[model samples]
Target: MAESANPIPRKAAPVRTKIDHLRLDVVGPVATLTLNRPERHNALSLDMYHQIPEMLSRLEIDRTVSSLVIRGCGLRAFSAGADITEFTTVRAGAEGARLYNLAVAEAERAISNFHAPTIAMVHGFCIGGGCGLALSCDLRLADTAAAFGITPARLGFAYSLESTKRLMDLAGPAEASYLLFSGRRVSAERALWNGLVNEVHPPEELEKVTYELAVEISKRAPMSLRATKEIIGLVRAGQVRDDDYTTALRNDLFESSDYIEGVEAFLGKRPPHFSGC
Candidate 1:
């Protein structure tokens, strides 16, 4: 047979998510959300962005969960960023891009506003929107050889204001501007020095160091940690108002069962069993 001169075009199959691009598993009092796309360096699709906030919301009210950790499954990357190939189709123009950016912003806010302390356990490449994800967390811990960058400029795209503001809050103007302008990957040491990551450990020690931090945070009084996280965000925004919510947050901690346990434990010279009340 000569075969056809031209092949007929067929519709692409819709992406399957029965097996989630994101996975949530609760280990003891800690909830770990793993980005499950290592084949593409855990690149995030629109669906993964949407799923993150949902998982965060679920964990926010689960009293049993004392903390949350976000990471990629394999060694190559925490996440390479948004799936850029999606751009050619569903994300082709300004409107599509606007909607996509909105989803990304919402996911970031969810992480930043999460009720429990959250950690970004980064390894390998954490770039573009990946950096946004890490910045959204309460803390970022990176492998010593990990690479970090935020490169909207490389794509001829302006950085989103909310993401830029968060990055600025973490690294200050000079460091943020340097990263944004050059769009170059910085090593773990440079990332630590620039305040882009809280700590950097050798690849062999990355998990040990990150989870140790998570464990220490989990052992603290949960209510106090949650309130502190909330207040610090306000402080960063130059907020000083003692409004109703602020006043309540300040007062209610004293009334919590954890408060009583903390005090009793201090006096008794024993570990406290906080109920997170």
Candidate 2:
């Protein structure tokens, strides 16, 4: 048979980069981020530390996104914490460890400082840095199968003050101490009781429940949500002083379109269509 000429053209391949290690997806007013390293149970890699903050920066300016969700690739873990294999290589010496820790700190700060509300959708093992990630979010929603623990004691490392304070804020000093001291995984029931998680669902219900919650949050008045988040942060840090910045934000609420719409909708006996002004 004679050779036939090929007619179909192949599509161009997408450009790729190191940050592809993290998957970022935005749908409507919500963004979902998946830590793409599943073979290591979604261990937070070195690239991820830099990538997380960069991605968060993008979302910070994205007005369309009202919320963000961070999760691992599979049901096995939200994350297994940092990539331990790198410790023997890149993070070998004290200086390396310090640098690595700094990267991790910046990543956590990015998440915690995100302008919009964030949620930790936890399933399976959320340990060490993973635990820190979950704690950074405004809320934690998990499957009953999920477990959480801070394993710095197990790794022969002391936990950072900010991380410890977050644990203390949520689980109380006693519970936080117990976890850090023991490095034992806490069951979902225990985590929930300790206030480590907001809600626990069956495995099948976890995603459905989490997305529903995110959707509900996204529909609310954006400025109100942002103000509430800031207020909560001030309360947490005990920085409730009415400085000029704080005073300005408080005043802006009165001028916001959302406030006017809310009032009109209430008086008109209709659902408020807040423009998130």
Clashes of each: 0, 0
Tell me the tens digit of each residue's lDDT in model 1 across 111-197: 988888899999899998888999999889998779998998899888888888888988899999999999999999998998988
Mark the 10 consecutive residues where model 1 has the least summed lDDT: 1-10
Q: What would the TM-scores of all predictions be?
A: 0.91, 0.91
In candidate 2, what are the lDDT values of residues 130-187, reduced to their tens digit? 8888899999999899989899988888888888888999999999999999999999
Instruction: Name every residue pair that clashes in candidate 2.
Output: none
In order, the Cα lDDT scores of the candidates are 0.83, 0.84
Give the CA lDDT, 0 to 100, for residue 47 in model 1: 88
Alpha-carbon runs more than 4 Å astray in model 1: 1-19, 241-244
State residue 50's C-alpha deviation in candidate 2, in Å: 1.0
**Candidate 1 C-alpha error for residue 200, in Å:** 0.6
Model 2: which ten-residue window has the lowest total lDDT? 1-10
Clashes (candidate 1): 0
CA lDDT for candidate 2:
0.84
Estimate the Cα RMSD of every predicted model relative to the unseen true structure.
10.3, 7.7
